[model samples]
Target: GYILFGPADSLTLFSGLLVLMLAPEFFQPLRLLAQHYHDRAAALGAAAELLDRLEDLPDKAVQKHENVRNADPGAGIVLDQVSAGFKPGQPVFSELFLTLESGSVTALTGPSGGGKSTLLHLLAGFLKPDQGEVRIFGLAPGEVRFGWLGQQPFLVHGTWADNLRLTTPDASDVAIETALRQLGLGGLIDERPEGINSPVSESGAGLSGGQGRRLSLARILVANYDLILMDEPTAGLDPDSEVYVIEALHKLAVQGKTLVFSTHQPALLTLADHILSVSGRGQVLDTSRGGGHYE
Candidate 1:
């Protein structure tokens, strides 16, 4: 016997709980699928909406490609003894110094809830470090413009092209076309009813997780930035798309673009010229892949 308590809404909440609690003898596979497949399902919804947005945006000039380097295309990033934590009272990782230079892809891998994302957030200027300094191309985080793609692909509703053009409103048709072709999306563009102007629902509804991730990656590819920061770039992608995106990342690195992405898979990590693994407590794992070659 359960004692009923709280306001009118409480009983409804309790009833919902009863539905879950009463289903103990239900099929295990269904329950497992619901739990395990949630992220995958959500990824699909996100991907579809992203495609729609890509089709909707107006044509504009692709951002001008400016070659930059630490001395001058891709410069190295430097974090001098930086520390970060959720609150002022307590900090997780501290005194971390790392250099992820241009012409290489660095994977930020670590245990679950480790400060890898937090470290990225610090480097991206989304979160100010509590200590030390973060510099890009010898400029502070705020000075330089970089692109950021997170675990969940985020998009503005409307059309697919609109989302693509957001980073570069002035992108010419040729530039956009080239970008699409580079990512094997040229045919996709043609298949869509609106071409690049295809409509996307909010937060990428119709596309699969892989499609959304690729679309977001495509947007990042089009941006002219010194550093590209991606969190869990391959988390929700299909095998083919993940491989495509990973290879594309390598190509960008070869082209002298600095990339720092977080990954949980060793396969996806192999392309990384460098690997920086962070611990659950914010300590970075050593023995990172060496041979920093851009060519």
Candidate 2:
């Protein structure tokens, strides 16, 4: 307006247009600065919320005992007056007393959400009881190196040998082959061009769920752990895979390895020397002996 209205020689029309064009460019930095400040504020708010959440979390103290009880190989597992649950004052098991014999196959059978997995977790030492004591072979739970087979099999982006060696680092090639054969993975390994050295997945093809689980069991076989705990070992497995798993577990039991597994399958139940039915009401009934209760 100044260039158009003022004296003609004072400001040229071209200079006026140039200033108009550069005006937005001159303020672009300031606009961006404001936007950046807004973004920074948002980020800080989010970080503050995260920090608050972290602060609200309960602190977990590491449990240590100077005189740790030595593991007694013959003690098996004992749960005395135990109570546990995810929430305080709501226990899954209240004053539950149980004992499992060594060198025996025990099966836990019950409805879903009946605390089968919770009991396994207690044995695995993945969870702590709200009250009472849990001992595995006279030692505290999780103190001993026991075999654990969860529903999901753990595999890596490597050869079969690599996956098996994850738990048993010093395992020999012969032992690896033997373990694979034990779990009925021998043919799969043999099919690979490089045998055990071949990558687990070839041509973007990975093992099926059952085969993957078998591979995981093979690791337990190679490790030769005295106490093995499995959570629904045959759940979601194909028919053939289930057979392989059942056979492997049977072999383990015959070898006098203490095996505890959670299963509802009739075939698996037949393998158990003792069958305990866990109920949602926190009642554990020893169904093997014509309905006896364990308290």
Candidate 3:
């Protein structure tokens, strides 16, 4: 049997134990709040950086002068003394005078970071040059009807059909199937029991790199733009896939769409109607006509 301690003594011991049991509960909310605050700070920093980037973007012309109707009737691209760069005095290419005829294929090739992509961006109206002018279809670059295939094509999470439909929402089933077959993606659809409904994850998780590139090309076909600008169109593709994509691109060119692409692949370069070898200073070091071997 335990001896009875004094009431004051027992009360003191009980209070100490109670305090120890409640200490964690007291600080748990504070610890959680601190972690949340840290996350918020990180998010704020990222947002601020993004805002700075947005602020740096060149402003689009507000006037309606950049419309297709204001341009020449014929479709082609012309760059006159165009100079561009992300930073001041450090241009990717300077004083470029390029002319791409309608219904022709032109390839631009150079060492990495040599401004091939920057030229495409200038043509695509994503970036404005610090000097000179760009004309597409006889109008400003923004007025041109065009499709751009970037180094990495983005595929949203959805079915294959859904992704294609994003290019042309009212595209018919036959048209969609036709575009897939043209891009050599018919086999992908055939393999899937779900067919066009086969699920595609973000950035095309289930598709191989070549398949994704082909799929992106097919999406371009559905959109049916006048000019198709591609950056490293066949990069990371297997030999067979590259050949197939090249063939598809040839067909597109034959269909009268102007094609401009940047590539290091000899095979792809061979497909060009004209090849411009870019120099470190962003000037065309050499220009060669395509052998038209595939034709």
Candidate 4:
């Protein structure tokens, strides 16, 4: 008979091997927990800071503005002691006052980056004055019928007719052709076989700078709003194109469309019924012929 190995000795050997296998596995979770403790603490701290910042913000007050008057096509625009800026203490304008009559062309002349566009924004109600009032048609900007053209024309990847159709989708071919011709696009239309249906790249890439701008003007022309606001409508146009644009503007003024445009061009300035020279100190000096008024 073979000598029996002790049961106790076998038990001890098996137990030792089991403990060796489980020791690293048991400590792995503990090591991971230790490593992530700092991450959790950092997350908690960030959340606390966000909550504190949210709590520090002041509550906004909401009030309903009533429009008591109906739309008046001949109503004038008035800015009473208006001030505006992107930031406090670094205002674009301060306590500015002026009045613009309907069916007249008012040119705002100033150095570039001197709140000319800001003034347009204020008039369009795209921005709010920090202090003062902008009354258009005896109502707020939101309550008026107006159109705006920025320094750059906004175009899309479509035909010339398609862009114009944005303002009047139901416009006929004759109407579209007439609007284009008014903006001196007759040459441009004839150059392309597609005419008004000619393809226009996004942002008017295929068209010249002047063509794009005139196209932009064509949209407003078709809309025929009571008030038209333009910012540097002749910024990149050649001498010929500039003349055409000025003539078109004069025609609009004759049509009794209240027009306000900002420009640095001498020719554009001459067309204004009144010229308001905006100074850095928020002073509006009327420098038109026979106009010595200041506000």
Candidate 5:
């Protein structure tokens, strides 16, 4: 049964001429646990105290000194002669070039491991290219503020509203409700004995995969950024939820917000204004090369 813990194990041989011999190795662990009971209890008490303090403390949010106006002239993203790869001898992407305008939806697609996520990470200013440049407007990648949603999103230990309000501090209750309703989370929130005030466990253990995905999407929706980049946005979604997400994305695109997302879903692909197809071998083939960059 210990094998269920994982692949690591150790076996010892104990032979007896008379017939049977079995070492009571298991009892050793129990004896040690008993000896350490007080210490463990103390540690647990300390942890409980620390968590109580954390709950009491104001969520330690970053100070919002600057205002986010509705009509801010955001910078455009430019990938100028960008080339990235793991090794000098072999490059996953080469001489890659694309520009994401201030208001458009760009869809990136390709076979598995085609460097789609890597490219997005590059554009998001996380990874530096081995060669060439990725610029956000006139500034380097770091100069701009963008909201990115990866395949898996991390949730905060609070109510669902906390996750949704990450982008706009002043987002109204009505606005949040509308977003959640569109994504089918309003009922779940209401059914919760806690309602919006319900305490969400750490990492959202109380939520299912679909619930987590919706919550993650809500977090992105609440945030109003110059550019929104989503990787595999609808991969784990159910059919109805996927439709809602696609509708929301389309609405955002129509609102003049820029979006760049990678997806394997056919419906998501159909929503794309432009597609960046990556070959299985790891190269970006842009159909928008004729001054018709990714949608």
Candidate 6:
């Protein structure tokens, strides 16, 4: 308006046009600076969130040399005056005294939030007791290698033999084949062109949940761990997979291997030599042994 309406000399008109042309260029550095600030803020926020999550995680337990001991065949699992939980000063089960005999199949039946898994963790040496002792085969928990069948069966992007050989690298091919057959995976293996060497996930298709779990059990069968622990072995399994798991566990029990498992299935409970009912409040009642309760 000043250039068009007001009196303006050539020098002033040229200066006004030059400023208008250079205005965006003049603010270009400031705009870039603002964008960088925004990016820095987002990055810092993400880093802070990651740091908080890391802080919330529990510290990794360091294994002590003294805690390592050889397995004693005669001695079984013993939880004496044990109290443990995730939080400090709050125990899931307190002053608990329990004993499991060697070569026995013990079943832990309990509610969802009950300490069944906690007890298993204690036995597996995944968690430490706030007080007292947890002994497995007269040795500290985790001192000896054992079979663990968790709810989520682990698998890899490899062949059937590769998955089975994960835990038992020295397992013979014959042993691998036998284990798969024992777990009712024989049909699946035979169908594959390369048998056990065939990729577990073929043509972008992986095994079903049941098949994956059975494959995990096949590993246990080949490894021949004297003590095996399973959590909800039959949970979410199809009827066929359930039968295979039950039969496989029975076979293991017959081999004089001590098996401890947590389950709600009646079929699994029948396999237990001793059934212990675990309560949500941490009480364990031995339903099979004269209804004795452990405190």
Q: Clashing residue pairs, candidate 2?
A: none
- Put down candidate 5 lDDT per residue, 178-281, tens digits, no spaces: 77877788888788886666767657887876678777777777776767889998888778778878888887888888889998887887766677787746
Candidate 5: regions farther than 4 A off: 1-75, 86-89, 280-282, 288-295
lDDT, candidates in the order shown:
0.74, 0.86, 0.81, 0.83, 0.72, 0.88
What would the per-residue lDDT of candidate 1 be over residues 90-147, giving only the tens digit for each residue?
Answer: 7767777777766677887778787878878887888888888887777667556688
Q: What is the number of backbone collisions in each predicted candidate, taken in the order shown?
A: 38, 0, 0, 0, 2, 0
- Candidate 2 lDDT over 35-80, as tens digits, reads 9999999999999999987773544212223213356758889999
TM per candidate = 0.71, 0.75, 0.76, 0.74, 0.71, 0.76
- Kindly provide the TM-score of model 3 when superposed on the true structure, using C-alpha atoms: 0.76
**Quality of model 6 by C-alpha lDDT:** 0.88
Candidate 5, run of 10 with poorest lDDT: 61-70
How does candidate 2 score on lDDT?
Answer: 0.86
Expressed as tens digits, the lDDT of each residue in 145-216 for candidate 4 is 687888788898899999988877888888888989988899889999989999998868777888788888
Candidate 3, poorest ten consecutive residues by summed lDDT = 286-295
lDDT (tens digit, per residue) of candidate 6 on 183-294: 9999998888899998866322568889889998998898888899999999999999999999999999999999999998999988889999899687899999565789
User: Which candidate has the highest lDDT of all?
Assistant: 6
* Off by more than 4 A, model 4: 1-69, 292-295
Model 6 per-residue lDDT at 185: 90
Residue 221, candidate 4: C-alpha displacement in angstroms? 0.7
Model 4: per-residue Cα lDDT at residue 192? 95
